[model samples]
Target: MANSVFGITDENGNFTIELPSWLHATPNLEKACAVKVIQLPLDSVCRLRHGPSSSHGIHLSSSEDGFRTYTTGWIQLQQHDTK
Candidate 1:
């Protein structure tokens, strides 16, 4: 399957996550999934610790075919401050 996760960063430095294909295959699809988004400060070591963290991103995990699949998407930081 070509399940994928996408992330979009807004002008305010916030992020929006796009559901995977498998999760939205049906009109009333309900599958277990996990999403994580972390905002890193500019020029911070936190990014290194997190392996090049993005200003906006998403992490997704779902069960499929007796196995779990994970996907991620990274978005560049916006100029405007969201906080």
Candidate 2:
């Protein structure tokens, strides 16, 4: 998941997306399309080790098989470091 994007963005927030040779682009995504990019909070990320992760951000069970079916719980920030 990490180290996927490797391009410098200009001041206008525009950059060329060059995927590695190992990665493949889906036919539908080959052309410019409206993509939904999600950025999870630092605490919600599993590697942060904030607390006992309950189902990774407490999602609601849904019949949809896609990620849109999942949702995160209320943002709960701790006052101190976990370490």
lDDT of each structure?
0.45, 0.38
Which pairs in model 2 have colliding backbones?
none
What is candidate 2's lDDT per residue for 1-83, written digit by digit as tens? 46345444354433456545444443433232222223334554333224434323324336354322223334343454467
Error of 2 at 7 (Å): 2.2
| Clash number for candidate 1 | 0
Which ten residues in a row are the worst by lDDT in model 1? Answer: 49-58
Model 2 local distance difference test score = 0.38
Candidate 1, residues 1-83: lDDT per residue as tens digits? 25545565465544455565566554423234433444456653433333343232324357677543444444333344345
Q: In candidate 2, residue 29 scores what lDDT?
A: 33
Query: For candidate 2, which ten residues in a row score worst on lDDT?
Result: 28-37
Q: What's the distance in Å from true for residue 53, model 1?
A: 8.5
* Top candidate, metric TM-score: 1
Give the TM-score of each candidate: 0.27, 0.26
